[model samples]
Target chain A: MDIDMSLVDWSRAQFALTAMYHWIFVPLTLGMTFMIAIMETIYVRTGKEEWKRITKFWGKLFGINFAIGVATGIILEFEFGTNWSNYSWFVGDIFGAPLAIEGIMAFFMESTFIAIMFFGWNKVSKKFHLTSTWLVAIGANLSALWILVANAWMQSPVGTVFNPDMARNEMVNFWEVLFSPVAINKFLHTISNGYVVSAIFIIGVSAWFLLKKRNIVFAKKSILVAATFGLVTSIFLALTGDGSAYEVAQKQPMKLAAMEGLYDGKTEAGLVVVGALTPGKEAGDDKDAYIFKIEVPKMLSWLGYRSGDAFVPGVNDLVYGNEEQGLISAEEKIERGKVAVQTLTEYKTAKDEGDMETLAQLSPLFDRETSEGQEFYENYFRYFGYGYLNAPGDIIPNVPMVFYSFHIMVGLGFFFILFFFLVLWFTVKNKIDSKKWLLRLSLLTMPLAFIASQAGWIVAEVGRQPWVIQDLMPTVAAVTRLDASAVQLTFVLFAIIFTTLLVAEISIMVKAIKTGPKENEGGK
Target chain B: MNRRNIFARVLFFYVDGFRNLSGWGKKLWIIILLKGIVIFVLMKLLFFPNVLNQNYDTDAERSNHVLETLTKSK
Candidate 1:
């Protein structure tokens, strides 16, 4: 069976692009739904017409976001079977459980309540209707939670065991996997980030309204609520981001190395903020032959190990020679390096080698029985013939996407702190409405918050690069073999449908915002 | 107490509690349910699988066994 590597690459690329685009709307739905619930509950409690107006306004937006989220999400599920058939088969048992539960428990609860929340306003009592809204919010967040759990499992697989008999991985205990450290931390970080995204979204839109002097009463109140939420969440996010980085360093050293663009182990590594990593170069170079260059400071160790003097391996260290001067024999170390190099070469060659015997030997060694061998092989393979092999003992992360994304996310985090603080200061001093420029800037910053949240997630997921589940399974090995054409067709179809849904959502939201909530004819 | 009197007393307590809850507690409860129970439980179930005891050593091995079982059944 001849498999075209281009086709797989194309399909995978399409899938990632589509999923990412779809995800832009998902966290908003999850976070905004909760915010809407809060707004509506406030209305129900205070019986203030203003709160009701706020509730109705945000509810409309949530509805639109939710629809787009659902539409885009459905496409991803199909892609797994169609594009990654082998992956489905490989981790289906462990992977299928969470997805099934998500569908049956979380999806069902969320969808059912969402319908009630949307259409039940007139039919149900105020209390029942409010309850429905709360349920819908619960449902949406639950959906995110379940999906993250599945992703987290992929990030840090737990409670599973190797079955030499079955020649694959299988679930051993469901409980152990659920409570894995990675899953718990990732879940908190993701949901909190979602909240931050929604808060920024609210602040941005409200600031725009204030700048325009439209719905001043509602906009002021909305901004107050949103800014408060955004400020707090941003602070939380900064802390969580730190913790997540620490975890990444511990579990995914390669990803950490990639993020910092470290080519050699050093006592103190500088954190590169915004720099181009030219794939095959030394730290200091002036020409095209310069491979990987990054800004340096000892910040990597400070962040990852919490000590400036901590030793962090660079790409070269991981690939080449990094042993105690006399701890191990030189011959043995070279042999180890050779084995690692051979494994990586075999895997890559098998993709294009067309030799069955060589592939057979290479493939099984990458299996559970010899994953250590696979890792060593991959590290060496990365060093050999890559033109950037001069500092072979360094560890390089396949994380160009993550490195930039992380910085962008962190940069935005600080931006929000300043933006919200200024808004709060102005508002308290009764000068918020008087300052049109600040209002406009605040309004514009909302999308930036959402962007930061999305980018943060991208870094978290993409940084894990080669592993689907940390050290347990490599993504390449997890993929299923289905016709690439099928994946392409589905991807195109989804792209069209999702775009339409997004357009419709925006139109509806625009109409709702323009119309505003109707004034109560007679105080009910 | 007489049935009428008992009903009246119960109604008074219910209205009083409702009024208090309507101010802020209701809103807080809703937020908690949405963020805490719904999202937390779902994410836990999906992203983090329940790892039962098995004879295998690695997650990949266990995953393969499960897949084989499912395939065999299919």
Candidate 2:
């Protein structure tokens, strides 16, 4: 029954590595598929050969990116069973449904129409091919939606009941899980981030073409579409980001505390406008961890609760109880969780012995029909993850990592807004292709977009800390009992293979772009 | 004919397909197959350890241990 800490760490590291690599291509695929569709739609409407050429060119790049994304994504799906077999078993009852549904509904939709969009140019009717292109875009996004819903459920588990006998969480209300506020906000936020990344990518590459003046007209038109799209999605990304913060504040206050590096309870805690934290600072003991910090007065409260004066419990307050915030200590939750765990065990033994009295008493704690039963269930069942914890401090996530990642992501988000605005303005002035410095800046934003996307994931995932499913299971308890060396070997293998695929993908994309769109035989 | 002949025919085609490849293509295919085997079989057989299932032997025993730990109040 001993949990190997090293195995858990290595497994987590492996998943993170694969996920980050998978993410590099996914956002672009999500963004560019729709861009190509838009171009084709224009071609369909205007009957312009130029629009068709543009669509075909971008579609080529999209196909290359899509292939590697599919390859890495397949690996990720299997790793769930291979590395995290325990977590797969524990929550598979509820978790497996969305993934399976995604494969049936979204993946099928994408993979089927993708061929038509790529190779059916002269074979199919223009209208039908256009429809297929749009379908590919819709399918890719729908796939993202389902995957995010699954991840969001892990963050805020809903519509599920704990089945002690089966030793797993089972879905009770699929609708609740699908439509939970967290899932919806996560979908909106994540997809908008994708759109913004794609827009930046287009603008950057178009800037390169403009600098060389190879495809000036095509580059300008592409920049116009991407910049406008980027600007709108950037604004939406910021708004949904606020909604995400509010959800975290409500469902995972400790994560919020880690993200902001808030260590002391306050009624109106100021938001860290810009901050630098001291290295190796511990919460509860190190009060002044911020080496340099700027604050916006009462902004955190207003953002989190829609009120400027609402009490927000800090990290220390959650680890050690805060009376004002009505927060109980993690230690207290551990004790309650232990009771719940013990009660279930005894109940199992009684059932084995055919003791009806003990069964009746224990049944109320698991039942949710009556008011008393619901209260008991809420009080003890909610803290189930705490039972596995040895100390209250184990609940605290790596604050410095979450804090820096959040700031970096937000900073880059604002920068993108400004960058897109300038690009759009210059295009209107007829100077977009003429400005060499601005083109270089636009080109630089391509990598920055990826960095921001990765940072966003780090903030969301690492901020959740020990819990894989918040309050239900700690990651240490959820990893498969595999040897650390096995995980390390697989991790290295995945790293090498994925890196090779990434290099190949980039080289092919560069070559495609260098070749440019094929000339139309009959038209300019 | 028989199952063995059918298998041999399939294997022959697979090997011939590789043999027909250019030098670089052949090398690339070999590298890919070697990596696949190392990842799928050799690594798993030599390194991957499954102690959780081994230790408890049964679900009932594991559940019992977890319950005992939880109920043991300080």
Candidate 3:
């Protein structure tokens, strides 16, 4: 059966579209819920009616973001079963566990507490209401935890052994899958990024209020909390980002190479602080990868290996093989992967035919308990996705996209730390209202937070392209063989529906912000 | 909070919340409702279905279908 490359492209586009849209709402929910919880805690402690009003106001915005997040989130999961059923079947045993756990967390925890947090205002005790708000925050972050665990498994598949008879990877140790270093780093990095985005969101909205000379007290207090949270989380974000880079260097060298636009292997490689990619740069070419570059010396090596002298492979090294570094070329992996694919089919055929002799011989090759099986699994079966590719170049992801997105995300991250510090300093000095330039910049920074968040995800996903589950399955092999037009149609429909929802959300949010917390009404 | 009583409180909590929404809340609720209908109702029911589960009843059958689909030359 010939592959419909168009179908593969459309499925990728649709999934990316849904994921990107879902993300816009999720960070706000993650960040704003905690901030709202903090505000409500102050109300409970101080017995202040004004703090309660502020909590209610921010909670209202959080609720608006949360609703759309739930809708888009469901669609993203279903896209797996619908469009990428091949990936669903291959790793479903391992992948579905996290998502199912996430569902339980979202339903039993987040939904239940969020209702009480939002609506049980006057009906519940102050402490109980505050506890409910905190639970909602924890529940939402836990949901992120499970999903990132699942995503991390795709980036660096572990704790699963492939069973030829079932034609799927089965989870062996649940703890190993859960606590994989990649999962921990990814979960922490992602949540902190959300916190930073949320802090920016709060500061921006408050800055707008300050600019208009409306709710001066409200805006200043919000900025104080947001800036403090932002500064702390921005530091956490950088630390986890370094941890993520280390994990990527170890488990996904191709992604690391793409991220840096590195073409030649090096010891003590410089981390590109700012650079432009040379036009039409390709791996193994004579052309230099960067047009002009400025880099922090030895940072890349130190980031990846904790040693400034450590060797770091690049695109050319990954593609063309480096025997000195024990790196097998993509071409060699494809050859071994072809044999593994063929042998799996033969083994299945033998088992079905009741060929006991052949089965006896082949069984050990799939069994990790056996030495032969361990070797075969490690060397060949590990490269199974490579068999699906037509050329060595197919192994490389969209390098320029990953490069630019990664740079943008990292550059903005450093800027945010300074931005938050300055915002807090100016506000603390009682000069926030007077600083019109800073106030306008704060308002403008909100969209940049959204961009940085989106760029971070783009770097993670696009940097690991071709493989849906790194070295286990390429996206071309993973996509369900639906007609191209069907996917195109659904993609358009989702585009329209999501756009409509986005518009409605913004309209409702702008109106809610314009209205501000009901000055006349309190604790209904 | 016993289980049934807690459940009842949540049920009424949501009901009362919906009942008491002011203009902005109601507008947001409308978007939520319309979007819920479009996504969970229309999209899930009409557009997207679990292909393997819908087509095959047993695990063995589903596995066989997926294996054939994946290992086949593209």
**Best-fitting candidate, measured by TM-score?**
3
Clash pairs detected, candidate 3:
none
The superposed Cα distance between candidate 1 and the true structure at residue A384, in angstroms, equals 20
How do the candidates rank by TM-score, highest first?
Answer: 3, 2, 1
The list of candidate 3 runs beyond 4 A from truth reads: A522-524, B1-11
Give DockQ for candidates 1 onward, in order.
Answer: 0.05, 0.09, 0.62
For residues A1-524, write the lDDT of model 3, one tens digit per residue.
25989999999999999999889999999899899999988888888787888888899889888866666899987898899888899996687899889888888875678778877878888888899999999999998999999999999999999888888999998999999999999999999999999999999999999988998988898898899999999999999999999999999999999999999989999999999999898888899999999999999999999999999999999999999999989999999888888888788778778999999999899898899999998888888888888889998999999999999999999999999999999989989899999899998899999999999999999999988999989999898989899999999998998887788778878878988878744456
Stretches off by above 4 angstroms in model 2 are: A352-356, A521-524, B1-74
- lDDT string for model 2 (B3-74, tens) is 999889646644654455534334434554654665456644554434435457786765544444333321
For lDDT, candidate 1 versus 2, the one ahead is 2
Name the regions of candidate 1 deviating beyond 4 angstroms. Answer: A1-3, A122-127, A274-298, A325-399, A482-486, A521-524, B1-74
lDDT of 1 at A238: 77
User: Which consecutive 10 residues in model 2 chain A have the weakest lDDT in total?
Assistant: A515-524
Tens-digit lDDT track for model 2 on A1-524?
Answer: 25778898999999899899999989998999888889888889999888887787788678777765664565566676667656666685577898888878765675458756754666568999899999998888998888899999999999988766556678999999999999999999999999999999989988988998888888888888899999999999999999999999999998888888888868888899799987777767855868999999998998788888988888899999986668899999999877776777777778778999998888777767767668867888788778778899989999999999999999999999999999999998999987899999998899999999999999999999799999988887777656798788888977887798788778867877787766772142
What does candidate 3 score on TM? 0.97
TM-score of 2: 0.89
Candidate 2, residue A154: the lDDT equals 91
**Candidate 2 positional error at A156, Å:** 0.5
